[model samples]
Target: MEGLKECVANLVVYLHPSKAKCPNEAILTELSSMLFTYNETFEGVVLAYDPGNCSNLAKILPGIHPYFGVKLTARILLFNPKPDMLLEGEVVKITPHSIHAVVLGFSAAVIADEDIRGEFKYKSKHGKEVYVSKSHKKHKIKVGTILRFVVKSFDEEILHLSGSLLADHSGCARWLDKNSDKWSQADRF
Candidate 1:
């Protein structure tokens, strides 16, 4: 969530001669192909796009194929997580050695045992696995729980993230929000 942002870009979408009848649709289709993939130019993964101010007249190149370029201003939503940034995700799987979560319902994140702080201990309850905080019994992480953690590294190729739970400010997001005042007061000492 921390890395999500919107940016405006001036783009030229090339269209084949056959698609000249509906240039708008052809442009949309070309931009849609960029969704959910990492682009080095944008330096992030594109989540969504909106094309605006399209030119009715396109420039037809002199090539034999006669491809035309449609110019437009586009708004793009991108996700580009960086090291030490705090991020939230849903716990999809849990084990003694590692915790697996999905960030933004797309990126996969993993927090290994070493990355998890010593304040929490892994345990089983009702045949369910969880990581429980030793200091705060109400604060725990289990499957489906929304967790906040620090980003250690990210693999842009596969949209995979390496996360850590070593900060006092990181844990169950709901619990942290609900008990913000109390947590802050306790953290002072």
Candidate 2:
């Protein structure tokens, strides 16, 4: 808001089509500069682009603008997830049936009780008497536990993360050994 001149952000910019009308290099350079300037507001932020996330994401405004003969409107589209790697998150909810977690600035993910670890379960506090794993009696899933997971699946917004320590947890006993490195720094995540 400081030194910005009185530039009318019409949200519509017309582009020339052919080199006969406007040279390609000239248009490309000029348009690129304009786009980058405006797109600064969109940098590093996720936008609702698809119908899965928001149905009105790409919907046009109530006004109409025609270029030469064709009509034009605005739209919001998604960018790919960055770095293409596994991410860590905190388990926000722990239950007898499933574990709900969230990645930082992302979406909620789920790890079913059966999918959490190799044959792991905890007795529910309500005590309806369901099958519980005896081995997991010592280590129970609790809130705010940092869990490493991979993005199993994702749409525009929803995420399905899996806590499958496929390579790390080679065996049950090894898991206990690796995870029990120290109890002093419990809140490391």
Candidate 3:
């Protein structure tokens, strides 16, 4: 794994609890606006071992104090409305050096007024052809079918994820509350 020499370190520095510098109100306002529109609530933050930084530690540990080699932590947020509807045990296979993954056993429901149409699509790799319903009868998928998927990579230029999806889902709510402790109740602006 490529060690996160600067990126992880920078994230740790930015999320440090003792740090006084934080995102400005304007940025927070924008985030709140986006969250509200999406019908999702901001969750707390979670600290986890950064895989990238762990590589760097291996090379530097001999010269530095052994105690300094502990895994570095990265912060992530959790969202109420999952970025996508994913079922447990869904196989998520990530392509190395790419920001996309293949998800298996997934189905989506398209609800139209007075009628519900269930559409199924499966894509196993990025840039690959997606298999969709050619006939209505072909769309019948079991509840736990392993459907192929190509999810946007977290490290994509636009997504720029700080950590893994699981990490974000675990920590986002807590981080929001803890970081907002200094704000007054009326600071929702």
- How do all models score by TM-score? 0.95, 0.39, 0.19
Best by TM-score: 1
TM-score of model 1 vs. true structure: 0.95
**Shift of residue 9 alpha carbon in model 1, Å:** 0.6
Model 2, stretches more than 4 Å misplaced? 1-85, 125-140, 157-189
Question: Per-residue lDDT of 24-66 in model 2, one digit per residue for the tens?
Answer: 3433443345331224344322333211111112223343542
Pairs with backbone N, CA or C atoms under 3 Å apart (clashes), candidate 2: none
Q: Where in model 3 is the C-alpha error above 4 Å?
A: 1-73, 77-135, 147-189
* Model 3 Cα lDDT, one tens digit per residue, 1-189: 111112233221211222223323322332334321212122211212222322223222343333222233332233221233322222223222222222211212221111111232343555443323323323322223332221222332222222222211211122224444422332454
lDDT of 3: 0.26
Count of clashes, each model: 0, 0, 18
- What lDDT would candidate 2 get against the real structure? 0.41
Per-residue lDDT for 68-114 in model 1, tens only?
A: 99899999999999999999999999999999999999999999999
- Each prediction's RMSD over C-alphas, in Å, is 1.3, 14.2, 19.6
RMSD (CA, Å), candidate 1 to true, equals: 1.3
